[model samples]
Target chain A: MTQKYYAQIYVTLRPSVLDPAGVAVRSGVQQMGYDNVEQVRIGKYIEVTLNANSEDEAKTQLDRICDLLLANPVIETYRFDLTTVSSEVQTS
Target chain B: MTQKYYAQIYVTLRPSVLDPAGVAVRSGVQQMGYDNVEQVRIGKYIEVTLNANSEDEAKTQLDRICDLLLANPVIETYRFDLTTVSSEVQTS
Candidate 1:
């Protein structure tokens, strides 16, 4: 039987990578008088729902998708959390 | 006293909002033979480091920022997690 899984993936720039967006945000914060703001990094958050035979398959699929398309391996790193959707929602 | 804090903000289209990017991702998943994939919502993940007097202050500042500039109140909803930076990291 297949189960529905939900994954939340966060893709962020490596510490060494130049984050122009982050810099702009930092500047904005400083301009707004939030003088203590620093090292602001902007990233992408993707939420995917899919079906698979098991947790391992769900994770494998998501990992493949992230590595191939969702994240840039040279400058960005990604992490994700996969959760099994309970049937209670299906009944509701 | 001010302490350094980090926030991870996830901005996503509301359930009622139309998500064209999500539609394209869904189509891509279907083409890739992931027939079970659904609701591929795309969003922005922002990481910010700043100084705040307390955890409550941190949340308030972030919430205000999200409402004012980070997220589009018309179509997107946002949530965030705030964590304090340890002094051990400051020393290291």
Candidate 2:
């Protein structure tokens, strides 16, 4: 049987980049009387599950997928956490 | 002095809803030759920084903001981790 893998990827804009959405949200928070808002940046969170022979193979595929398609190279950066998709947890 | 707080929020779709973006990514992955792709879901990650009198006050504001603006009641749900925006770490 093939192994199951799940990954959560987080993609965000570079700090130097101008994030219009973040600015808008910041202003909105102020208007809402939260007056304490300092900064806000929005990003993407992607969850994916896949089948592979092993974690190493799954990782290679994940790297390609993120590099080739999931991210915008111009202003955004990304990171991911991979885990086995298992319901049972083993405790020592 | 006011305390600075930073929050990382994760918003995701409910399992019952249809996610076209997720479907599209899964297809793209499979087509790219990583035929093991099983499922995909797309969501939002938000980073916010603010000044508050205390952690309790920050939590109250965070809850309100997420309820009113950050997530959709009809289809999405969200969670956040709040931390003080301090660079110094105290280790025992």
Cα interface RMSD of each candidate: 1.2, 0.8
Every model's TM-score? 0.94, 0.91
What is the number of backbone collisions in each predicted candidate, taken in the order shown?
0, 0
Q: Per-residue lDDT of B1-92 in model 1, one digit per residue for the tens?
A: 98989888899988898879878877887787778787788899999988889999889888888887789999899999899988788654
For candidate 1, give the lDDT.
0.87
Best by TM-score: 1
Encode model 1's per-residue lDDT on A1-92: one tens digit a residue: 98889999999999999999889887887787667777688999888988899999998888878887788899999999999998679864
lDDT of 2 by residue, A1-92 (tens): 67789999998998889999988988888888988888999999999998888888888888888888888878888899999977465345
DockQ of each: 0.78, 0.77
Off by over 4 Å in 1: none
Which residue pairs in candidate 1 have backbone atoms (N, alpha carbon, C) closer than 3 angstroms, thus clashing? none
TM-score of decoy 1: 0.94
lDDT of 1 at A92: 46
lDDT of 2 by residue, B1-92 (tens): 68889999999999999999999999988889887888999999999999998999999999888888889979999999999977465355
